[model samples]
Each structure stands twice: as structure tokens, then as C-alpha cells.
Target: MAGPNAPWHQKKNHPVRRHFPFVLLFALLGLSALASAPAAALEFELGAGPVDEIDGDGTWIATASWLTGQRHPWELAVGMIGARTQAQGVDTGDVYFVSVSRRLTWKRWFVQGGIAFTDSDNEVLSNHWQFRTGLGYDFGRFSLSVAHLSNANTGGRNRGETFALLQVAF
Candidate 1:
């Protein structure tokens, strides 16, 4: 006699399902903020490199960021990043994250720090808080950065990761 309305069918049974609404709300707010921004105020950056691993098996990394606007020395951005590698006997181990960053710049040079919420398919890692920091050079339309990412020891296993990336903004 169970149907779609059955208690077992309810989203509360699943942990992530229970939080879906909140995640959706946060995403909507972020999108609305971006939509209200000036048409020419968006800056985009894309970069890729390798992630260092404790076992000497590196992962391929890539990231994209959108800089919305600036306030004095601080620039605000939202970013998505991913890394992939092999673990065990399977081609596994991947991590993805969404983050917000604040950058302080001095003419052609800049430093940034950000917090990220992360998800990983790797059994050795868990969904956790991630911190990122980097320094880069801005050459007008193009830039280069060397960044580090870690769980700040908040997670039981935090080996950390690093990447050198190139960026372009319009």
C-alpha cells in the first residue's frame, strides 16, 4: 500500500535530501546577487595544473573563477575546482568544490584567500571545510597564480594539495 506519499518516500529519510531546500535557497540567493551586477563587471578565470600527492601519484587539477566586482583592495569571486587521480586498483579519487574568494591586490600583484565546501569520491577524503590561498601576477587581461588547498586539519586526513594556474579576465 506504499506510494509516493509514503513515509519511506519522504526526503527526510535521506540526509542530503533533508538539506536540499537550504542548498537550493543559497544557490538562488547567489544567482540573484550575480544577476544584479553590472553587465561589464564580470571577470572570468580558468586554469589547470597538477596536484601533489603523498604517494607521489599526482592528480590533474583545473579551476574556474568568476570575479564579480572590486571594493578597494578586495576583489570578490566565486570559483569551482576539481582534481582527479587514481587510487587503489581503480581509477578513482576525485574532488570537487565551490568556493568564495577575497583577493587583495597591489597593481600587478595579488594574494587571495578563500573557504570552500568540498565533496570527494575518494574514500580517504570526506566532505569537509577547505581553505585556499594563493599569490599571482596580473598582466591586465591575463594572470598567473600558484595556489594551495587544504582542509586545515579539520578533516582526519589532510595531506593538502597545490597547483599553478593561469587566468584570463574580461
Candidate 2:
């Protein structure tokens, strides 16, 4: 007997269980087809992850934006973000950002670099400015990004941070 949500191994032992790779391949192809045929210009995303070294140790973030220039070389986005730590008594901040990036496409791979400004909401930690750049790849419907953020004031005590993001745009 197995629970409703049990893993396949716990539910049954069968030869069909070995066909996962083929199932995944077909699913990916279906998603790619859907992604390439788009009907809207606005996209929304929400994600949560752990942020190392912060008292809030675990960070949860959300983003919403309007994207234009569909699949073009030059792209622009305007959005707001709420990033907070999960630790007790830690200050969580919400900021607004506007970014512009150019897509460099090579085969199925692409790289994008962008600059953004954040309106710091936490007075103690806010210098009101941060810069970001990302490297990504487009697999029809999915894009993976590795990005970094640095404070504008080098003379100040603010430390820079980096984030690795994997995005699915549909």
C-alpha cells in the first residue's frame, strides 16, 4: 500500500517507470512550441530562495514587469521587487527597478547584460543604487541567468551581492 503522493518506487515497481527520459523530452518539445507562439507583452514572476550571510538567512523575492520588443535584440523592463529575510527582527526591503538589456544570440544560447536602479526602502541599508548584469541562455521557453549586484557608493560600507536565477518565460 502507498500514500497518494508517494514516489513511483513506493507506489509500484514496473518497467514503464524507466521511460521518464522520453516523457520529459516530449514535454519539453511541447513547451517550446507554446513559448514561441506568444500573444501578450506582459510577464510576471515570483520566486523564493536562500540568501547566504544575511540574518534573514532565507530570502523570498517577487517581481512583476512589462516587457516589450518580444524576442528582439534590445529589450526593456520596468518592475518592482520585494526582497526580505526570514530571520527574526531583520529588516526586509521593497524596491523598484528599471532595466535594459541587449540579447546576444549565438545558436540556442544567449547572453544579456543590463543596468538597473533600485529605490532603497530601508534607510539603514539603502544607498538607493545598485547595478546588475546577467548571463543567460534561451532554450525556446526557458532562460537561465546568473547575475551580480553592486552598490554604487564604493566609499561606503555597503557590500555587494550576486544572484543566480533560472527563469521560464511563457
* lDDT against true structure, model 1: 0.61
Which stretches of model 1 miss by more than 4 angstroms?
A: 1-36, 71-92, 121-125
- Give the per-residue lDDT digits (tens) of candidate 1, residues 1-170: 54556663364443235545654564565455556667577667776765555455566676666666664232333443444444443233456666656678888788998765554423334444567788988888888889877776776766567777777765
Summarize candidate 2's per-residue lDDT along 87-143 as a digit string, tens digits.
555554555554455557777676666555454525223444455565766665556
The candidate that achieves the highest TM-score relative to the unseen native structure? 1
Can you give the lDDT of residue 40 in candidate 1?
78
- TM-scores, all models, native as reference: 0.70, 0.53
Superposed Cα deviation of residue 39, candidate 1 (Å): 2.2
The regions of model 2 sitting more than 4 angstroms off are: 1-56, 65-72, 79-81, 85-90, 121-126, 152-155
Candidate 1 displacement at residue 24 in angstroms: 4.0
lDDT, residue 50, model 1: 59
